[model samples]
Target: MSKKSTEQKPEVATVALVQSAQEEEDTITIPVMDIFRQMKKYFLPWVLIAVIAAGAVFGGAMLLSNSKATPLTAMVGFTYDGIEKGLDPNGNEFDANTLKSPSIIESTLTDLGMDTKKTDAIRSAITISGVVPDDTIDELTAYKSIFESTNSVDAAQKLMDVSYYPTRFEIQFAYGNSEMNRSQAADFLNTMLSNYKTYFMRTYGYNDALGDALTAVDYTTYDYPQALDVFSSTLNSLQNYVSTLSQNDNTRFRSSETGYTFADLNESINTLRSVDYATLSSYVLGKNVTKDKASLAIYYQYRIDNLNRNLSSANEKLATIADSIKNYQKDSMVVMAGADATSSSALTQPSEAYDDLISQKTDAQSSVSSYQQQIADYQSRLDKLNSSAVASKKDQEKVETDMKTVCDKLNKLIDDVNATADDYFETASYANSYSVLVPASGSVSNAVSNAVSNMMRPLLIAEALLFVCYLVFAIVRAFIVSYRRNAIATAAVEAEERKEAAEAAEKTEETEE
Candidate 1:
């Protein structure tokens, strides 16, 4: 139609531009935003699956955690006496090792009616804890709760671990995963205490006939002071009765005076002294009254001698203290007055030394007064002994014999009573130090929060893992779909190019023909 000049427009530029655009488009690069967008389409399904998986995990964990695998706990308390000799015979302070030793466990299990041959079992089941004070049991209780939750491997670890205090110890025993009765726990505790006590008692020699005898003796009844009182009163009453009897006795050679005069006694003593002193002493000793009197006199004389010795010692001490005081005073006076009394520079300030000297002087004077009083009391006793009259030897012999028999019986009773006193004391100490057993609650202490946390932890982890996997799956699917679409577009583009080339070639062939 325009046919004046048929001109072929060069379409090469357009084709090249289109090809270049196509090539640019052919290259597939997925940015992070695209991947997220692709994943967003399946996000709800992924979330659903994750939730379901988490729930399942949670349920499973709960089922396992709530299952009958909890520990049973018992608590027992031991009281310790602070008596060093009784409790620590080995001179070792009470330590946790003594209670936690394998030997102690072996013995304890034996008491529990478990074969000691199964020591490993006992060791595994029982834990002896540190000693604590009586007031701090709550601290141990809180510790046990925390420890049990975290240390699930040995659930029974809290049960047998011991908490020791200075004056006492609290012990915990746990039987793991048992649905036992509270009474059983009580029985276990009692047996444990009994065995533990028996162990110490036997080890320390407290479980013998002597121990029993000691327990039977009452401490309040043991009064040595009372015995002394009885002895003194009996001697005084006997002396009074003998004095009256001597006054009543009007047998031949009875003096005109009510009692023997000093002159008469002196004359008699001289006459007796004229005789062979040894023979007269022997003759006096044959009669019980004279013998007892002579013994009493000798005892009083010895007491007076001891008092004299003490007085001499006290006097010597007083003199030494006095000398020290005098020296201190002299020094103080020298300091106060100065070397030349008129010299003011030489005068010294009073110091504590003077005060100490004055105090010492007062103490020394008090000691002197005490010694003088003691010496006077000794002389009084001596005078009484000299003035007191003994019965005639013949009549005195019978009364002395009767009194001697009674005295021997009393002495025997006194010895027997005193001998058991120490044993009773030890027994009382054992009782005070003994363990007190109470039934432990058998209720399974479930850490509800901990169990839930433990159960939920796995579920949460699973949910996170599954969500990550889902995200990966969704992104991979997006990449695969995008790749397939790009490959189809490229194939179409290549087919078009081949077709175009074929057409050009045919056209050229025709043109050449």
Candidate 2:
């Protein structure tokens, strides 16, 4: 009986071990229902924490943004026709950064009656960048590839040296530190740009040096021959200027204000040179008119000597240039025989150096001819001075009258030409070269949108983080609660099993007795 009891105890122990293993497996397995209940229970607290976090993030962002001075921005665009070649209409290199030059800023402040002390601030606030197109890089890359594939070292070098500039440029004015309101900043930028346009026109549109020189000349200080020389020089300058204008592709363009074309100006200049100039020159030189014959004779001799020296120098230069031209070898390219080509052929062309030499030679010959003519005129004048022919008071008076009349006509012609040229340049020549394609405009709406977006971005991120943290806390809390309850139920089951085992052992001992 004791032996049977020991075997039964082993079976009872096995059963208890199996029951404990089952209880542990049941305790470790978690149910989806408990998780859902815990989440629901913590939903209100999670929402409260999330709302607080979102509020803090948004308020902080707003406060930080508001504490800093928000920049008032304005944009302006430039449309320069000559931007492709990086040149202005006057063949000067174009620089977009010059838009914010100190000179321009100072002028703007002066024009706007603003404080000139803000010049540096305004310059600092101003930023310029080219509005490069999306395809510009691709185009540049393709160009570089094609040139590189050609295997031409010079072409490759030139390509490497090439710089690109955009026709459209963006001008940004950040006015946070400039102490300017949005409206004021916009006005200042627009005024500054307007002043720049005026400056650009004066600097590059048309040259006023010749006009100013002609206007400043006081012909009364010169004798009759010298006065004739002045008129001749002025006419020659005017003819050359008009000739350059006439050579432009838009030579037929007529000025709306002056009602004159370049062709008309050229015609007027030619007529004056041929008719008025010839008449005055003939009258002055033929009469051998002079304010003081002794002084004039001495001047003529000096001029003759100077001119002879210049003529000799010019002749020597001309001879040297002629020899260079005769001995200069032109660059040539040899083409080997091909299916469509002749046996072999060589093509020759004048290099830039050769062409430059030819041009210099032509100019030297022209200078020599001019010097010879001047020397002859001065010698003739000296000869006339040597003669005992003294002009009477009547001849002098007549000469003076003709001189005044011709001077008046020349002055009038100069005035007309100035007016026409000014009108032509302002209205036609440079009218479209540099322009404000887009005027300065404020970005108030965009600024507001950006501020809102900035605030919302941080707020959303904080809220998302809060949500994840709340979920993890809720899940951990749920697991802790579930574990505690399972541990207590497990302990109770083990106690009950021990109690039952004790009772069974007592019954078995009694049965054995």
lDDT for each residue of candidate 2 in 78-135, tens digit (9 for 90 to 100): 4446668777666688778877889999998898888999898789888888777777
User: For candidate 1, what is the lDDT?
Assistant: 0.51
Question: Could you say which candidate leads in lDDT?
Answer: 2
Clashes, model 1 = 15
Candidate 2 lDDT score at position 129 = 80
Q: List TM-score per model, in order.
A: 0.35, 0.72
TM-score for candidate 1, residues paired by index = 0.35
Best-matching candidate per TM-score: 2
Quote model 2's TM-score.
0.72
Which 10-residue window of candidate 1 scores lowest in summed lDDT?
A: 1-10
Give one digit per residue, the lDDT tens place, for model 1 in 269-361: 333333433233233333322334455666556766786787777778778767776666323233335666765433356768777767776
Shift in Å, residue 56, candidate 2: 7.7
Worst 10 residues of 2 by lDDT: 69-78
